[model samples]
Target: MNPTTTALRAGCSRGLIELRQSLTNAGELLNHVLWPVLMLVTLFFVRDVSFGQSGFLLGTLVLPSILGMNAAMALVTMSHLLTVDREDGTLLRAKSTPNGMVTYLVGKIISVSGGLVVDLAIFLVPGLFIISGLAVGSVGSWLALTGLLALGLAATLPIGAVLGSVFTSARDQGLLTLPILGMIAISGVFYPVTSMPEWVQWTAQVFPIYWMGLGMRAALLPDSAVGVEIGESWRHVETVCALGAWAVLGLLLAPVVLRRMARRESGSAVARRRERAQRRVS
Candidate 1:
């Protein structure tokens, strides 16, 4: 089989494993799933509120923001799991195969993409029908939303790979949750970016989540929180340009980070640290 096909097959295998595991645990009511449900209910009660149909604007905005949040969580979860896999010798065994990175990344894309689809269906679909109603009327808008979600996933996957390669254990994984949640809060996932200060908004723009939220807002709303008109020449061009830039940067950086991480696997320092972590956990 070709390298791509081999990678793809490995990816499929990993995705199936993750999907079955996720579905099993997803049955429980946890903050990740529960919060969105609560928010959707809250929004439904106040559907008539608007700043120029900002109810519809907010409805559309929230979905992509949540998708961005999903992307962040996916990155963190995958990083931790991948690190554990590496420490436990799973990655080394996998690397013996052809195109390890291709296989690993493809698998992650499938798993994360699948999870996000369910997340959107459960969170956004109801919000659109219950709150925004017919605001999302056009096929173009739906296409735009899908494109933005894909960009969000593409941009974040590299970050996850980088994290996986860099972090060596579960403690580092716990530490990641703070920064990730902080970024999500500042990215305007739950609130409007406009409500945030100018400097804060600028800072948020450094991450893909903000751009994803902005692009989603543009696609979903007639009016934009970022002060640009969607589908306008400049706006449309900038959207394509920004997403493309992030995707390219991620692809370039991921391999470099992974190679460095692979080197650490054999070092005495890592082994000592891993042993200490195991002792602490035990």
Candidate 2:
């Protein structure tokens, strides 16, 4: 086989192995289940509450919006894993091997994206049972939902990888969570963006998170729910444009950033990072 093909296969196998381990590990499994379960419980209590005079159930609106937010979170997960791996000498080990960076990245993508799919299923299945007003009966709805999910992942994952490459440490990674939480608040994960101030709506639209949530709402909510959306429509074209722009920007930057990060990884550097981490723990 060609060397590139060999590396790709190796990376894929590595990803699958890691994914299986994550699924089977008790701690990791709990991490996957806990949040979705909490969200479901929240949905259960609010499933019947009306969204003001919009006549939409708050739970029904939140279900898909949360899915989008979770999808966008792929960015954070990718960045977090990259930082951890770098600190633990994983990136250095890969750097010493032939085409190691390629294999490492491919493997990470598979594992992260695979884990995301499982997480989504965990949230979505029980969510469907708890919420009403979903447009799931039609084949088109499922297709659109799938497309939106794919676009969402594409939009966020590269940016996440780029973020991971830049942060240099887990402590820096923790700082990112605050801004992400703030974005979630303004992005309409649990409520309609249209309800926010006009400037707030525009500000939310500047990031991929809002488009993701909006796209998801377009997919799962009924036509009647459109009234609560910006422009009183799903704005599918704008969603595509926004997510696509981010995808392009992230893809363009990730390689450059990852390459720079890889260049700086050496045994002494990794050791120093470990020492710092240990001191923090102590």
Candidate 3:
């Protein structure tokens, strides 16, 4: 059998093992259930509230937007987990093995993306009951949603790996939380992007976050809701283009970034990071 093919198979098995472990881990289980449950509570409260004069329920608008935000969040998860593995010397272990880095990355992407899918289902399933007015009954809605998420994951996961590569420590990765939150704020996950300033709209468009949210909205919202979006349209073409571009960029950058980061890893470096972490704790 081919070495690369063998590595891919190993990576897939590794990812599944980690995912199963997470499902059983008490802390990990809580983390998975918590956010989506909170989101459902939020959606429940807003189910009847109107979004300005748009006649659309705020809950309706927010539900899919939350889905988009969650999808984009795959980047954060990928980066955080990678950084944590690096700090704990797991990455160093991988570097010692043949084609281990590639295996490591594939496993992480699968683990993270799998977790996202579970979280998405948690939110979306109950969310359909909690909110009214979304186009939930159609096959098209499901197809659009499935495609958007697949693309969004493809778009964000490698970028997350790049971030993880650049930010060598968990503390360094922590610094990104604020900026990501700020991006979510402007990405119109919690609100309409058209309501933001024109410059804000343009700036947000440059990132995948906005496109993910837009894609989610297009998938789940009724056609009438398009009036509130930029250009009074869902801009499906633009959504695909923006997300496709990011997907390309991430795929291009991840290997280069990961290879560079992997080359820099050593037992001594891992020891130093652990020492620093211990010092911080003390």
Candidate 4:
């Protein structure tokens, strides 16, 4: 194979292996089951209403929003996985070899992005049938929703890279998870941002999560989901514009951040960290 193809394959393989390993170690099955089970149980016994009537009034809308959260979570986990590999000396060994760093990183992105796609399908497909009917209207609306989802994932990558660079161990992941999940909760994933304090709504708008949720809502829900004026005009166009801007910004910054991380990763640093851990455990 050509060098480019070979590099892509190597990167993809490494990424896939890491992704699977991370999921198994992290209880990926528990997470998947937890979300849908919580959602369905609340819908059936806890709430007398149909899916739409439950407090999740936007059941049709919530699926895509959750999918966006899934994308962000997947990217964040991938970032942490990469960091663990680096910390354990895998990255140092690979750096000493003929395998290119760029290829490996690209493979990581591809592998994680593939996992995100699968996660979305797993959540949304059965969700459409079970919770609420898929009602995006025409083929065009479906296309727009798909585009929004892809762009949202693009926007999530840089943030994930930054998080991965900062955090080191499973303990760190536990501490960081709450903050990240809080960000999502406040980002209007569960309800309209307008319901929050003005300051909270303003804060939510600053993150890609808000735009991702808004974009998904725009795509899935009917015009009624937004304000009357916004619904009348079909505000998805604005969502596209806003999300596109975030996607562009994330793309521009992700590589620079990742390169800085690669530069910081070294055999000596990995060894020191490992030695310290050993000392602590002993």
Candidate 5:
């Protein structure tokens, strides 16, 4: 077998192992379950409340949007994980092995993307029951949901990897949460973008998160619910174009950024970081 092919296979195996570990470990399992559980509790409270005069249950509108937002959260997850692994010398060790960098990236993608799918299921399965407005019985709804999810992931994950490569420390990575939260606030995760100020709507439209949420809403909400969306339409073409642009840009940039970051990894650098981390902990 070609060396790269062997590395890819090994990477897939590593990803599976990591995925299994994440699911089985008590703390990691709790982490996986926690957010969805919280979201469900929130949904339980508002499932009956109607949104403004739109006559749509707030929970129904929010459910699919939450799904889309979570898909976009793939960016933060990938970024944070890469930063943590680099800090722990995992990247350095990979640099020492033949074809290791390729395998390492593939493994990380598998682990992150696999974990995300599980997280989405955790939220989506029960959400389907708790929310009422979704077009769950239709094949077209499911197909649209699946396509938006794929596009959302493609649009965010590579950019996340690039961001991860740029940040040198966990502290800096944590700071990223603030901007992400701000984006979510403006991205119509909890409400309609059309309800926000005009400038806010335009700003939200610039990010993949807004397009993702809009795509989900288009997929799951009843056609009548379109009354609350911007221009009172699903705008599928714009959603695809916006997400496609991000996907292309991220795919183009991630490899170059990752390669630069990987080249900077060394035994001495990793050792220094470890020492500093230990000192901080102590």
Candidate 6:
């Protein structure tokens, strides 16, 4: 068997194991459940909300956006995990092994993506009970939503790996959250992007969040709901094109970044990071 194929299988198994561990561990389970529950509560309060003269329910619109936001956060998860793994010497261990970087990254993507799918389900199940305007039963809705999710992970995880490798420390990794929060604001997760200034709309479109939200809405929303979307259309082609661009850019960048970062990892460096982290905790 090819070394790459062997590494891929190992990564898959490793990811499934980590995912199982997270699902079973009380602390990890809580981390998974908390945010989705909070979003559900928020939706409950605004289930009947409408903006301006548009008759669409804000909660219904927000439900899918939250799903998209959760999907997009795969980037955050991948980066944060990479930072933690670096601090703890996981990357160093991988660096010592043949094809380990490939194995490690593939595993990380699977674990993060699998966990995210669970989180989305946790949100979507009760979410359906809370919001009524969605076309939840449509087979087409599920298929489109799944395709968008795959595309989203493709767009985000590589970029995340690149960012994670670049940051070099847990503290710096935390800083990445600031820009993500800012992106969410403009991405219009809580409301329609059309409500933003034209310049803001253009800026948001440059990032994957807006397209993710738009795609989610397209999947779950009724055609009539497009009235509130930009150009009063779902713009499926635009969404795909935008996310595809990000996917291509990220895929192109990740290997070079990860390779450089992996080469930098060493036991001494990991120990120094752990010491710094310990001192901070103390």
> lDDT: which candidate is best?
2
Residue 5, candidate 5: alpha-carbon lDDT: 100
Work out the TM-score per prediction. 0.80, 0.98, 0.98, 0.80, 0.97, 0.98
Q: After superposition, how far is residue 16 of candidate 1 from its true place, in Å?
A: 3.1
lDDT of each: 0.68, 0.91, 0.90, 0.66, 0.91, 0.91
Candidate 1's residue-wise lDDT over 102-172, tens digit each?
67767777876776677667777677776543337789888988877787677777777778887766677
Query: Where is the poorest 10-residue window by lDDT in model 2?
Result: 165-174
Candidate no. 5 TM-score: 0.97
The segments of candidate 1 whose C-alpha lies over 4 angstroms from its true place after superposition are: 25-32, 38-64, 223-234, 266-274
Residue 147 in model 2: lDDT: 91
Shift in Å, residue 159, candidate 2: 0.6
Q: Which portions of model 6 miss their true places by more than 4 Å?
A: none
Q: Which model is ahead, 2 or 5, in terms of lDDT?
A: 2
lDDT of 1: 0.68
Per-residue accuracy of model 5 over 65-125 as CA lDDT, tens digit each: 9989999999999899899989998888888899998898889888888998898899999
Error of 1 at 271 (Å): 6.7
* Cα error of candidate 6 at position 227, Å: 1.0
Candidate 3, 1-282: lDDT as tens digits? 998998899999999989999999999999999999998998888788887889888888989999999999999999999999999999999999998987888888788989999999999988887788888789999999999999999999989998988877888886999999889989988778888999999999988988998899998888989988989989899999989999999999998988888889999999999999999999
Candidate 1 global Cα RMSD: 3.7
Model 5 alpha-carbon miss at residue 228, Å: 0.9
Candidate 1 residue pairs that clash: none
Runs in model 3 deviating more than 4 A are none
User: Per-residue lDDT tens digits of candidate 4, residues 1-282?
Assistant: 787788878887777886676467658656645665565543333222323332344455556566556665655766776677777877666666665675667767876786666666656666666655445558876887788767776777656766676766544666777777888888866555666777887787677777777777667766554551222344566666776786687668777876776777787888888987788789
Q: In candidate 2, what are the lDDT values of residues 1-282, reduced to their tens digit? A: 888888899999999999999999999999999988998998899899898998888998999899999999999999999999998999999999999988998899889999999999999998988887899999999999899888888889999999998887888888999999989999999888888998988889999999999998888888888998887988999999999999999999999999999999999999899899899999
